[model samples]
Target: MNNQQFQTPIEYLKGVGLSRADVLKKELQIYNFEDLLKHFPYKYIDRTRFYKVREIQPDMPYVQVLARLTQKEIIGEKRTKRLIAQAHDDTGTIELVWFQGIKWVEKMLVPGKVYVLFGKPGFFNNKAQMAHPEMELYIPGAQQKGNLTLQPAYNSTEKLKQFTLDSKGLQKLIAGLLEQTAKDIHENLPDYIRNRYKLAGRQESYRNIHFPNDANQLNEARYRLKFEELFFLQLKLLRNKLLRTQKFKGNIFESVGDYFNEFYHHKLPFALTNSQKRVLKEIRLDTQRGVQMNRLLQGDVGSGKTVVALMSMLIAIDNGFQTCIMAPTEILANQHYQTIKSLVGEGFIEVALLTGSVPNKARKVIHQKLEDGTLNILIGTHALIEDKVQYKNLGLVVIDEQHRFGVEQRAKLWRKNIIPPHILVMTATPIPRTLAMTMYGDLDISVIDELPAGRKPIQTVHFYEAQRLRMFGFMKDEIAKGRQIYVVYPLIKESEKLDLKNLMDGTEIMSREFPLPKYRISIVHGKLKPAEKEFEMQRFVKGETQIMVATTVIEVGVNIPNASVMIVENAERFGLSQLHQLRGRVGRGAEQSFCILMSNEKLSHDGRIRLNTMVKTNNGFEIAEIDMQLRGPGNIEGTQQSGVLDLKVADLTTDQEILQQARNLVIEIFEKDPQLAAPENQILNLAFQAKNAGLSWDKIS
Candidate 1:
């Protein structure tokens, strides 16, 4: 049987053969054809043209010269034979040294033979030298034509180095495979769609990505591929959402602006922001469509999502259907229940809470009530999805902070009823539109782009650990005004073998820094029990735990509006998206809030960018774009599980222009033949099925 192609590495080509193949397969997992094809060049060395040795200088990255090998000598004896060969062009001569085996070095080099060489020029003792530089013995018809063309460099497993199965050898293997792997014909966008969207062809894009042959071709390929990734991804998501909406045929909740009027007239709390009202109106329209509604409602911290959620639930109850909200953690679930339970005529809409911590008897009672349709609305954590818990006529399911729950877990809620309840997933983290479209493909999207009037944007600051005393003083001032603060860290435990600090130590430091009677403090981390966690969170909410030092377990753990300060220790340890989520914990109320990002001096370039981004904007969307740029799309969107299968050749985030073009071509081809049974769409079908099939994203991730 022919080999089953692999993906992501270039070490598996046929000629790589046993020893070298084993290195690639075991060390780097690059054991198949597909792997080599997708292994992108980290950096390219252009050998498109050449320059004389005289033109080369110290520290120049590229040097092309025609030189004669003046001499060849083995400097070191037996165990370490160091082959040193001197080659000179008309301009100057340079030493080429190899420290490993000298047997092949002697044969590869012949004195007084002129050979053209291209390598990084380094200066040593006032002379140019290329240590172990890549060389060619200038055989007629053997050397490449141009002096420099972008040489594709690849990474390989260390073991592969033993058999000389490194980048150069692997590139040799790929050149052969590509020769046999026929140039796929370009799939033209249908004349109409191409003209409409001004997009490129799918086939041409693929060819260009790997073998652009020229710069323009490379650009064309890159643009088409990126576009395809984003477009098809968006298409699949939008299509799934559209199909689900079509299948739902949900019960329409008659538009009751009168309820808003009544609530506003009487027990109303405050005016809703234009964004909140706009999102609510969108939800209202979705729910009134006579089809089940599954929407992801996103807003920044304290942007009134709970209000929108409650209003949507009210629409369901107003239509006589039951609704439930599930939170990832007890603190959050309980908090949500507290805020959502009082939206309507208190006693009019029955509400109940069930969590793992609930007493067995009370739990059974609540379960019975839920099954009997007595509870108008329910809110809880994982306890809500337990097999023992059943909902009577469950019409809507609202999940908060959708990232915390796995895809299957969220999907489980649909099975709670014969007709899957309309699922509305909410997240305080405002994912950018492109990311949201792909990440939350199974649901429709609605963004709350505005905040309520009078709500001040959270003031964000990035500080080093040295500024601890000043930060502590600032916190003390906020606390003096009767507010709270949260100090967060990255790790839960200290590794005895390692020196890096942990939350426990950070907690200890904060304890010492703020010490005793001056401030009350509570420490909550993953190691704590649920009840213990709830207890500490309760105290924090009640203003007992004046300073809460914890780990990122609190990323989605709790929402303390009164907790006006968010201080993240070693902030560089977290991702941009995570930093934003942690920051979202604060600024939940009307009072002004602040987020302090405490990073160290040794922050990575990307980490610095992430920290700088947080310091610049409270806008999650902007942060998401920056996150996408920093972390790439697959990672930024929590799509790592499916990311490999999600792409064929392009990075949806970085190569968006190419993705868009490919998508237009895909659509054009598909429109011409729905089943992709046509000759043109045949390649498209193969690409998709080959990628998506045999792929259990859950397992791989």
Candidate 2:
């Protein structure tokens, strides 16, 4: 691939000079010719049809009309002023209006001259009109340009629009670049692979993508581009996984000794589900293979992931090595420590908890034991990665809610061991399969799909504010049965912009309703200090408080078996994944639990879909799929940080088939030529290198 042509500065483009290039770079991150080329259009409009003036209707989406301007007038005054022009064809006359660029429109409008106007039609005063329609001069006896079909619509910012670089302007610039370097565009795929897929040529795809001759050409162009995008992504991810497996050697756990056997046979708390057993087998096989195991363990809340993680940790201990688990928050770290400590029993495993809140004296003793190899397992927050917290023979590292931590922090943990310990990252949020394929494709994934026996699925319901009395009665009934309740608000304090109930105000209302002696209420939110928050949480956990009024901060970490009912105030403000996680907080106990979604009578289309989806199912994966469809992959929590979903064309939600095909092809190619050293595979290597010139692959590996 010739880098010089594509690397040319955007300022040199025919339509964009230095000033416009600066705005393009800042607003859209388009710096060079290659960046501009990769900036694919979001949508397209058909340009082959021209509607007569009489055929235009208010409901028409976007129409093009060939008409001559018969009259022009400036109407209204000040900010409301607009330039209006009457245009007529053989059938009738329609109005065209421009509110902002009145002077420009006035100068462009030449009375009695025919022009082509295109825009969405709107009804004003019972007549059809178009606002800010695009205009082009009409030539007599001129041939239509090769049956032009679709016009690409590039996304532009208001800043770029100031320089006259809207979607159409951008289309013109791309056309110029394509015309100048049509021959310079290089094919990144190998000839054999392209033939197998029956894809269009790279240059041809680009030309048709920006300026297609027909719908068939446009469809072919989109297929080729989407395939190429997904193919390269899968190739990059697979190559990283292959390279890591080949280059890195891991400590081998040859035997499942006393530690693992004792836990399974004698200390086991509950029967392992089939899914759990299968996952355990997979982990055991990975550890015994003597290669670094980078695995992702995905399970919904209350799915018993901790038990699986502990069992895996025991394998490390059985091999005479220590293990450590890192969590994103101190509350979560403390919870894991307490749960694991009790489960392991005294003297079964010397487990220690280390967080910033730990006293200095306790920290000193923990550090000493860690260095002496006495602490068999350590659980902590970011404090675990401190320079002083050294581990002796660290063999396994487990990260809970791994997405919350940054890549550099994870790297810090990887460096603690000489030959990088085997990593097992766990998340309560179930990832959609398509997302897992792209985001965590490098890591082997094992999902605990089935819940443990004797657990009941939480029932979810929705309620409007008018049903507040009924909800209150239900809460009182649960409390009367010795069960606790959680009332979660979305905000800490009242916001002038949002009318939803805040935590403080909600607590006040609950206090007035429940009263003191019989009902005790606790409030927790992000605004409270750490100690204060912990106090309230402990109160709720201890059953001292009948209800806990809180924010989403309690979405994770707080697991109380007695809390059977969770009423989320203004649930419409929360996303599907968040609602699922919050619901997971309940249903921890064998008792039947319920999640009540409270909202106003009015709901937006997306808000209604989200709440409806939550009420329909408790399956985290199903909710995740819907959430991805509703908010795209970028908006999903923690996905934007991964940088893997920087997709230009292929959507993870809709293009699963394409992604799967691309992944299969990647596997076949790597299986045949792992190093891409074969003559036919060289193009794949070059393409990967050119595309990811300065990107970091540490996270992928």
Candidate 3:
């Protein structure tokens, strides 16, 4: 036994030489001995019992038997080939075809060898056929029905197969590794913990996942491992949270009296919603606290998040300090500016906007004002954090659409002050709890659940494009009633190809569809330069264009309350959350708003779910939940997104209890041994370090 780490994978183990090892590594990401033990099956075929051919039908997805390969042949070109074969039992003979596997069948076939065959029986050419069924060579008296029980189907890759690392090659290598290392499995969990949870030792858990003799064993293995993964994940989050809270000191500004009076007395164009008022109180309390305030302000679209943010900024300014708001896009930054400039009045506050496009001189002035404390509040995109734009007495940091920026970028804002600024982050994206825990566990959360008075909920409808004429007619009628319309399209062109067709196609179709010049129409998409896109978006926002036909690029977010209708040309292409966010653009005003999802007739189940979800409700949280459920567990871990969860085995959808159990356990552990240094928790600290180093499976379960 060796203590060295083998992160390479299963196929590259000592006994697994270049030939067979090549296959496993390529077909699977197995380059070390341990990977084989953990390479669980994607699915299982219960071959413990065999079925009679007479018992099989078109409806039966599973069938088993002893059969002989009577014949095998290949057809089609090299790129598109098919393997035709025949299998027979006493009841009857059936065709077994494997598309694109002709060569394997040809090499492995023998004239009269009885073997085990398993696959679905289906009708092709009005006869029975089993395409690309799993096959194993017959052994004398091999259970008679051979492979009659649960069978494992390991996932593989083409690169491994290229090295002749077929399924059998993988099975053999795994067997070799198991024989060598199976007995060496160590129990890292304490006895008391295992007994409390009724879990098996670590060794049994690993083996059961690989070669479980029965379903019960597999269940036990899954539970223990998943628990370990989730528990560690939650534990890591708690540790990070404790470290942050204990070490960081917030810029506490108490008695928000001056700020509140200045805004509430003579300013504040509209009365704040109760929810907004509540959130502001929370923010005020948070900023008054000693530790740095890492709070998330969650609200639905037009839920007064910005106003609440502004009031908090007022608190910082009233305390004779400055704050900065960072948005992901220029349009959103400018939109915030427009709202503040419109509502906050001119002289009471000195506000400036900084973006990448600001002129050199203008930027220099803004930077100087910021450094000298002349600037009270600044709103802009990433330009707010550029090396030159230093802050004076920076007390609060407000990040809008916080998800758009990375943790590193946000941290930079916090670090601008001697003590990290009291952080108040805002998001229009109503993320679900499962996702929130994984992403926002490091911060305190405050949600603004109420909408302002006169705010209207968007009326959503799902329909196929075949009903386009009727939908357009309805839009026309709405437009005729002194309202505007947005017809959004999907982008089919890359940045390289000039999508004249996208602009021309949408413009022409929309113009002709709605009686052209009778209704003013404009087009917008990503292909347009920032200036041009802004021009078209401005036109639509101002109601200068009665109908706007554009691509999903308009999803770049131009908030238009006057536009009462949103018609996504091919809604099926959008995720449920995206569709919901698009819908959020409208329904911000007092007027009734409508979202017409005009998707193509051919919609995938997920696509239909997306549209149906939109039709079901305007709740962004509900839509985000649906999206997470549909996307499954492993997928949400993209470059910036997936890292948020950082879970390995425990699934957010299925293992929520385990997540809670981990959280509760950590709380208990911390209560007793805050430093994780007690004898019972000593090994745990080491194990936690090992696990965290191996996989960042902590912080997000």
Q: What would you estimate as the lDDT of candidate 3?
A: 0.75
Candidate 3, 459: how far from true, in Å? 1.3
Per-residue lDDT tens digits for candidate 1, residues 672-698, read 665557764555456555535664321
* Residue lDDT tens for model 2, 273-345: 9999999999999998889999999999999999999999999999999999999999899899888987889
Residue 150 of model 2: what lDDT?
A: 75
Please give the TM-score that candidate 1 achieves against the real structure.
0.86
Candidate 3, residue 216: Cα displacement in angstroms equals 1.1
The Cα error of candidate 3 at residue 179, in Å, is 3.4
For residues 349-463, write the lDDT of model 3, one tens digit per residue.
Answer: 8899998888999989998899899899899999888777788889988888876777567666866888888887788777777667666766778888877888877888887
TM-score quality measure for candidate 2: 0.95
- Please give the distance, in angstroms, between residue 108's alpha carbon in candidate 1 and its true position after superposition: 2.8
- The C-alpha TM-scores of every prediction are 0.86, 0.95, 0.87
Q: Rank the candidates by lDDT, best first.
A: 2, 3, 1
Which stretch of 10 consecutive residues in model 1 shows the poorest summed lDDT? 1-10
Tell me which residue pairs clash in candidate 2.
none
Instruction: Rank the models by TM-score, top first.
Output: 2, 3, 1
Which model scores highest in lDDT? Answer: 2
Off by over 4 Å in 2: 68-92, 96-114, 144-148, 694-701
Shift in Å, residue 464, candidate 1: 3.0
